[model samples]
Target chain A: MKIEKKDVEYIADLSRLELTGEEKELYSAQLGDILSWMDELNKADTSKVEPTAHILGLENVLRSDLPEPFPDREAILKLAPQRELDFIKVPKVIE
Target chain B: MNNFETVIGLEVHAQLNTATKMFCPCPQADYKAGANSAICPVCTGQPGTLPAANVKAVELGVKTGLALNCRVNEISIFARKNYFYPDLPKSYQVSQFDRPLCEAGSVEIDLKPSGSKTIRVARAHLEEDAGKSLHALGSRALDYTLVDFNRCGVPLIEIVSEPDISSADEAHAYLTELKRILQWAGVSQCDMEKGELRCDVNISLKAAAVKELGQKVEIKNLNSFKAVKDAINSEIARQTAMIERGETVAQDTRLWNEKEQKTVPMRSKEMAHDYRYFPEPDLVPLRIAAARLETAKNELGELPRARKTRFMKDFGLNNYDAGVLTSDRCLSAYFEACMKEAPPSAAEGEAKAVANLITGEFFARANELKVNPEDYLSKTISPVSLVKLAALTSAGKLSASAAKTVFAGSWGTGKTPEALMGELGLAQVSDSVQIEAWAREAIAANPDAAKDFKNGNEKALGPIVGMVMKKSGGKANPRLANEAIKKILAA
Candidate 1:
């Protein structure tokens, strides 16, 4: 599949990234080359092999439901860019 | 309206009642907790933190799926739903997509006038809850929104239903049944006020002749089931009017404005987020072993519908009474416990008596106290005491009205029904000599009523019976009072 400049622009917008016209063109070409390189795997006859979501072959890695409170919650809250009292403040997001 | 039919489906999110968050060891923060008091490295999306699934939450998801009659998939993948929001510390929410935990289930809803219809469930997928956002504090609006990460990473299961509902009432019934089943399965509390249960509605109107459906409008921010029902009705009216005017209904998302009781369109830009779902490599696939599935099945003892049927069949209760008693798990358990206290020989009469008190007086008191009947059951009145009260009423030792008085007197007093009846002078005057004296006095006071009864005007016997009951201070057994009055009038 070919990655167009519009596709790159759309992805950048979704990621909340502001890109210049030159950056969009550059990313488009770079993405297209990456896709071409990954597409080489399509040539292999892998119909017999099952699709793998994870190569670790692990399943059902779970923890019990017991709760342990994080003692230093204040430390985590201080990491935010802006904080008011106990809350993390951000630009108005009505939606 | 006649030419168009309404189609609605609901997506309900119920928070799993696990002790901890879905992926982290942080305690499940209370809704009334301080802001950001439950944050952790994994839930706050700090770098280099890994998320492990909660086994209890998965078991609950399977239990809920089984209760809804969904086929539990052996293997389900958790995918990262990419989106940007202030409430979500992690830009990507780990949820099930394409391959869900449960699929192809159906919930049977009780329609009015003694009918039932099945609503098809498309899928039920497990996901984590986002944090809460506050736009305004009290009455003051702020330029920046406040975020509380206390609710972040809470476990949730999103149940999606097919568009089989044709009216708002059916949607309401569907939600009611769904909530009952979820609560009965010990899966979640399903409390709407506490945000343990939340619902979103999808509705559209299509002409009877058209095979293709109209544009679907999604309604959000429904805080209660009434809001859900009203929003669907409002949306139906709005869509039908547009269709009648030969205008196409725009496919968009709207918010239910509770104050105005109408749905208004949200900002167009709000719909631009494209959730790019990809499998999460951090967590492995969730595979339910045979033993785990069996354990879940065993945990889900009996669903509400089956229990309702049994109550009707075994206890000989009417549909309405059985439905009320079996509505809550704790209430049904209390009812059964009361039955166990009754003698086996008088099961039928005692069961009916017990059912009446539970659905009538017990529930009334619970409502007055603003408590759940199940929660209020053993707190004041034990099952043995309640059954004793029912037995007294059934044996004619206590008049029906007097039984209610005694019940109220015994509530929270730890007093037995018999003791309360004696203390309050509520014991029925079933003695033959006492009843006869009251009956004669009643006949003497109302000679005209006595004459009417003597002339075979059976309805006139009411006043004489009322007089006997009054003279005995409502302690006279009404049935015996009727016989006593008739004997005196015949003489």
Candidate 2:
């Protein structure tokens, strides 16, 4: 699972990140150490242990049939990088 | 033809009908509200914030498994599905691994001409929805790619099926049935049109005599069932042609181009070793107490299958009628509401006629409008008005043609059936005297056709019936028209 220096460079390119030579070497070692821990996790006995998806094991959580109005409109638009007249503005996708 | 059998499996992602997203109390809003409206810091994957799993989502996951006839797991767990994309926060996703909420469920789907097949369900688990990424690669009108976190952290139930499907038709049937069950159970909208429901397809081809499978290719992002069928059929053709040419199918994730009608390799598919799934440290093991599961099962109102059977038995509907009505929970509610005050007075049988009126008239119009049965029921049409209308139609006071017009008015104005009929002056032409005159005119105009009817040509009756209908401005109750025409023609 250890990400080698060369593979890390390739992945960083795929991820569109600008990495310096020194930072790349440092991250390679750091990623390798993390992978070794994951290796330990892969070795654990999961044969008898069931995988948990969500806590509480509750079932059938549903919304009431009543449709409610959108709340806190002003608060949501504030988090956007750009906004125009109470709207979050972004690059147009379709030509 | 080279002898190669297709081995196909399906991974279905169904958005839970939960009010809030899986990881937080943020409302599960996919679109419409606004960008980032439903997102929280936990969903945005801020550094110090942790997520608390949505318990309701887990319950829905188990219920979906149970519906497919799967055994519920005593303890289920979650793992991080590591991936890096702008849409997915934290560069990873929390999902189920070796332990799933339910295992060993199977759905039996019927295919026309080919009969039936049982698809084995591998497992079902809960997961969170991802944020959306808007790509503006080739556009000058945009500065950079856009994104919306409105869908971030919405709940999802994923069902994995064994490689049991061999044909596209069977796959379509399985998905259709699965959507029906989830919708009827009040679990999910499963609306492929809205993108709330989605599917990932796995396909491979092996030599007909080969016992094992060929290289498996996973295809992603097929939204519609038609698209699934088209993609699979095209892949089978492509794989078969390749194998015939001594070329091997590459194991990878291919994106299905619905418009181009082919699968193009997005990238070489990852082996499970790549994602490196590990149990999430923040989440604990989900324990399903037997009592809780039992209570959930009890609370699950009659499922579509059971309700369909009862509609056939108790409601005196045929198999098709029962299936059509009970396939949708909302439509079924509408049907029962219409039947509530209906007086059983059919010349044939009371319940049977009542069932026919519902399955025949109401559903016919509902389908034409493409309205979800629930939305139709949620509107102003009520049982009292519906039953009163059915009684009028049964008593030969409302013609079928006129009923359609009145039914549309009932939907538009939210007016009771009687009020609409009174306002429009659409009462049936059951006055034997007035209908008899039109019947006489119709018989005389089609003298030869009438003679043909006398000569025992049963089909001639149809033309005469149409003539009488047109003569009455489509207002003649069919039953009264038939009797009046018979009496006049005999005279």
Q: Rate the local accuracy (lDDT) of all candidates.
A: 0.89, 0.77
- lDDT per residue (tens digit) for residues A34-77 in model 2: 99999999998899985555556653333333223346645545
TM-score of each: 0.94, 0.76
Task: Score candidate 1 by TM-score against the native.
Answer: 0.94
Clashes of 1: 0
User: Judged by lDDT, which candidate is best?
Assistant: 1
Alpha-carbon runs more than 4 Å astray in model 2: A1-95, B137-147, B268-273, B340-352, B359-381, B395-397, B402-491
Per-candidate interface DockQ score? 0.84, 0.16
N/CA/C clash count, model 2: 10
Q: Candidate 2: TM of chain A?
A: 0.63
Candidate 2's residue-wise lDDT over B51-93, tens digit each? 6777677777778877888999887777788776656757788
Per-residue lDDT, model 1, residue B16, is 95
Task: Give the lowest summed-lDDT range of ten residues in model 2 chain B.
Answer: B267-276
